[model samples]
Structure formats: C-alpha cells, structure tokens
Target: MSFSIGIVGLPNVGKSTLFKALTKIKVDIAAYPFTTIHPNVGVVRVPDERLDKIAQIFKPEKITPTIIEFIDLAGLVKGAHKGEGLGNQFLAQIRNCDAILEIIRSFENPDVENVTGKIDPKNDIETIKVELELKDLEIEERNLSSPTKLLQSKSEGKEEKENLLSKKPIIYLLNTDGKTQYQVPKIKHLIMNLKDELEILELSDLEKKELGVKSKLDQLILACYNILDLITFFTVVGQKETRAWTLKNGQTAPEAGGVVHSDFQEKFIRAEVISWQKLVETGNWKKARELGQLKTVGKDYIVRDGDIIEFKI
Candidate 1:
C-alpha cells in the first residue's frame, strides 16, 4: 500500500532545495555541484479533506492519510548510463522507485555551477530523458543479445516476473507547474468520465467563493490527494466539525478499515456507504439511505472517489 518517487536532476539543480520545500526538513545545499553525495529521503503525508469529515462523524481517536516516499538522489551526469560521475550508485537507488520526478532548472543563474556546464530547461530535460531511455534500451539490448542465455534458466523466469516492478515511469515536473505534473496517476473512473470530451467554462461565483479556502500553495492539498489515489467521504453533525477520511479508489470496506487499523479489518463487519453525489442531490445521508442511494457493500466493493462510507464493524 506504499509507493515512492525518485527526484532526479543534474548537479546543483535545486533538488535539495525542492526536497526541503517538500518535506519542510533541512538538507545539505551548496553552491557547488555534487554537494550531496548520498541520497536524501523524506516521507510526505497525503493530505485528505475527507479524513476531517470522517472524524466529524465517527470521532475516531486518530486519523491517518496515505503517504508518498521521495528520494532525492545524486545528480545524473552525461555518462551515467556508462556508470560515470556517481552514476552506478545513483541509478541503483532510483531503479527501485515506482516513478521519477525529473526537476529541470528553467531559470538562469551564472553563479551556481551547472553539471552539464550550462542552463536550459529543455536541453536539461532531454539529457535526463535520454539517459533513462539509454538505461532502458541497454537492458532491452542485452535481453536481445543473450536471450537464450538469460532466459533459458528457470530461476531467471522468477526474477523477470519480479523485475516488472523495476519498470519505473519518468514524470517531468515542469519548472512553472511546480509539482502537479507528477502528483496524480491520471487514471480514475469518475475523473475519466468527467474529462471525457471535457470543456472549460469561465469561473463561476461558487468557485470564486471556494477559492478563499486556499490560502497558501493552493494546489498542494489536491496534489497530495492525487498521489494517494484517494477518495473522500464526509460526515457532518450539528455542533460538530465536518470530517473527511481518505480511501483509495476501488478500495473495499475492510481494506479501508485497514487504513484505520488492523484491528478494525480483523474484527470484520459490513459498511454503511452513501454516494457523495446522492448526498449533494438529496441533502441528507438519511434520505440517501432511504432512497436506496446509500448502500451496504461488502469488502469486495470497489470504492470510488467522493464516496461517503461508515463502517459497521
């Protein structure tokens, strides 16, 4: 239930500064390139508004959100594919990541040294992409060069099956976009439905009203939500704060209970679930359950984003 991303770039390309900004922890940052010889690691909470709403209803002793593990590894030089310039060590660390965040320094500054000896975002991006592609291609080429030798052994088959996890994706975190580019897995049922042949209209009055809630780093919460592939469910009561809990898309009730604790999942029980769209349309969870919009689903049900679930453990 855990995933990770590797932050990569050339030397002195603000990887450490970006890492500090992300985790809010201090790390070594020097004017000189290669200041960080060892990788810096940080785990960031996946913020979810649903956890608060869920708390509002259940008043749980604790609330937990999913997390993303990030690794700020050493810079990739031109000859990294050939194990040059701390290449083998860095590549080894990153090869295990579920995804990659390539940070390109779009801004220009002569004071800081550029490992490639210049500053250009597009060129820098290409350099990193090419190196990764080269790394992949090298594997592919070797697989082809000695297919009989590598694959003929039975043990090699098991290794190849497990090695599928090593197929990491390269996500470009554009300079202007901040971190949104790599935040979400662009695959979900509801969003897919909404965005299918999507169109944009001018901002509405309601949207303008909602904008006030975002005070700093407006998209940060949304980014965390995406990273977790989470769905939000809310609970509200009179004289109580509306609470939200995070559940993964397509997660079952028992699986979600596991998010809270192993004890809950172990105890075993049914779930009181209501669709958020129904609540908004009907104006109450009681009415939602009455209208058959609320559902009692087993652990096998695939949780959707914006679902309102209350486990009946």
Candidate 2:
C-alpha cells in the first residue's frame, strides 16, 4: 500500500533539505526564495521490524515493505491565493497528496533570508493556512455558480461544499537547530534537525554513534501514520514473498484485499486470519492452524493492525 504527503512551507525553511534526507535524493537547494519551481516527488519505505521478523521465520526469497511518497513543493508567499510566486502550481501539487506535512523553521540563519524577514513560526503557519483556505473558498464559489441543480451528483455536491484545503489533515514538522528548545505547537508535530540528520547519513556507523545521530525517519513515519489513522497487515506467500499492506483503521477484510488486487476483493471468499504475535508463537502457519490460532473470517471482519491474513478467492 502507498500514501503521499506534501511538504510545504515558506522558502528556505529546509523543506528541500528534509526531502533530501527522507528520500536520500539530491535536489537543488538554495538559500534564496523561489528556488524550487516544480515539486520533487520521492518514496520512503515504512520501517517495520515485523517484516524483518517474518522474513527471519520464513526466509522468503523477496521481502517488500510498505512505502510513503513525499512531495517537496515550492514555498508559498503571502499572496499565494492570488498566484504569487508559483502559488497556483504549489496548490495543484499539494491537492493530489493524501495529507500535508507543514514544515516550520525553528532555527535562524543569517545567510538564508526568511520570506517574512524574521522567523515567527506561528505567523508562518497561519499564512499558509489562510492562503489555502482562500483557494478552497474559490473552489466552493465555482461549484455554487454551476447552472443546473440536476447536473450535480449528491457526492460531488457534498464534496464541493466541503473545504478540501481545510479538511485535509496536517502533520506539523518542526525543523530545529538542535540547541534551542521550543514549546511544542498545538497541532500534531515532530521536531528534527534535518541538516544535522542528513549530514549524519553520510557518516559511517561508528561516526554516527560519535555524533549521536539516530534517524528520525522511523518516528516521523509512526507519527504520520497515527495522525492519518492508518494500520498495517501482512501477507506471506509460501516462503516466496512477504509484504506489508496499509489500510484505514476500520477497513473490512474485503477492503484490505482490494488493496492487494482488484480481483481479490470482487472474488473474495473467506480470509484466514491470525495475529502476528500468535503466528510467531506458533512458529509456522501449519502449527498455528493446528493449535486453532488461525480462524476463517468473512468480509465483515474488520482488519486490525499487525494482522497476518490469507485471502481465499
């Protein structure tokens, strides 16, 4: 399963630096404003220890972990709603993302000019919020101007009335200097020194320990998944391949199957279910079934996090 998140903030807030750290992909990073015109998209694997444990037990030929896509968008200035500084293009890039990762700069550097001339994280956040809200209002206005009532479907009408920008969930990412401690913001957020972390990635294992650089990618992934209300389930295919899948918190068995394959959901029969812990305890699928640790669940069964499933079609 896959998810996409858009990285947004004022220019030179380390948005590009964080993107490079997250994906380990080099992109142009400059101190001046409007450095990134188009967005850069990259995928980071969801770090799961359970997949490793399953691989150990089954010794699969191939192991696949879930992934999340991150899009690094250009900065938004004050008049972004009026199409200033690639504002329209930034909005378009972010609209396709599942959620927003608002990158807030907490550190001060004289070399990098702040778009507002000074760092005020709260004001910076409000600027982006208000601009996006204005765009959402425009969208609503266009829908309201439609001529025929019969032309609008119920779902589309309801969606049009909703403010997509305001409705999209946000995960605040505080880019810090690592020395000054700041009060945690009210919204869901995680603090990290993107520059420091990225530098650490270039070091050897021993060097990392000396610098005390523990990767924050795992924590970031966990925090984002929690904010999005996501869960993971696993499928092991006869020692050949083991994979992790993502689903919404309360999705049903068939819904989870649809994530794997379209036909799996349409022709889905009963699903064999067992908790990962139970499978580990039993040591193998055959023994787990013999011990009654595995049970057949129907389409109505709600998929839980860390569930190991086998779909019968």
Maximum-lDDT candidate:
2
Q: In model 2, which runs have C-alpha deviations exceeding 4 angstroms?
A: 148-158, 161-163, 180-184
Candidate 2, 1-313: lDDT as tens digits = 6778889998889999988988989898998988888899999888999888877879999999988888989998888878988888788787888788989888888898877877667778889999989988876666568745325644466444333776788988888997655555676568888888788778898988887778887888777776778899999998799999989999999999999998899899989999888888778889888988898999899999999999999
Worst 10 residues of 2 by lDDT: 154-163
Error of 2 at 6 (Å): 0.5
lDDT of 1 at 11: 84
Residues 1-313, model 1: lDDT tens digits: 5566788888877777666666666788777888878988897765655555545444555555556777888988887888988887888787777667666664445777766665456677667767776776776677679877567644456454334323455555433323223223232211111111111122355764566322222144355346545565554443344445566677677877776567868775877777665666676566677788878888787767767667677
TM-score of each: 0.67, 0.94
lDDT (CA) for every model shown? Answer: 0.62, 0.85
Q: Model 2 compared with the native: what TM-score?
A: 0.94
